[model samples]
Target: LYGAHLEGADLSGTHLEWANLSGTHLEGADLGGTHLEGADLGGAYLDGEISFAPAILRGAGARDINLEHIQCETFTEAFGDASVTLPDGYAAGEGKLSHWSPEKLDWENFYEAWRKWQAEQHPDLLPPYYTAED
Candidate 1:
């Protein structure tokens, strides 16, 4: 399925043994308790933007995949007895591996500032709560 959005689909506790799920957009899919034994998830985007923020990969085997750019809080409970092949520079551990803030990046900050400035030019679109008496 090209450019198909499969967000929030509950495929949990299903026996998908040896399934071919290459190049599928599984954004926000509930895969908890799903038996994905010997399944190939190569080049799959877990969070769409290279994020490892505690995906619902509980009881799924994610062996031999490039997970270098994934930034999660922890992967202790997710990857249980699974052979997960991460990228070269990343190691599985507890804590923040990467931090993404809109205020930190120069380009993002400038773009956000410009957007805010553009939005303020229109008075009608502005929320009424901001002009309310304190």
Candidate 2:
């Protein structure tokens, strides 16, 4: 498998060409530069509550996944023709999608900020003494 906790794993880089991975979680795994010719990954969660970000899905099949919520800033040429799937009540391409860039906040900083915001906005879902430092 190319990631953690995959239930049904048949991710042959050649067989799954141009598959869709929107809102899927494939954290802490390795895809070894697979050819994702035309996949879709809109609103996908490559990372978890930790600092680790998922490996790039460059050149994989990505064309119609929602990407408005992703933090990545640099997409591979594979995603050039893909369409970002939007959430309900939102326009198809109106989501916030970005690629990884050095200028963006570091993972630690981003996680901390995300935790803080989540705590403030949803106190019921907040854990006690939630700290992203590990």
Best by TM-score: 1
Candidate 1 lDDT tens digits, 1-134: 32345566766676654455545566667665565543435435456343333333322223334454454333322321112344454443322322112122243343343234324443333233333222
Who wins the lDDT comparison? 1
> What TM-score does each of the candidates earn?
0.38, 0.33
Tens-digit lDDT track of model 2 for 1-134: 22235323334344334444545655433333444433444334443221212334443323333444443433432222224443343332223322211123333453444345434543443334445453
lDDT of every model, 2 decimals? 0.40, 0.37
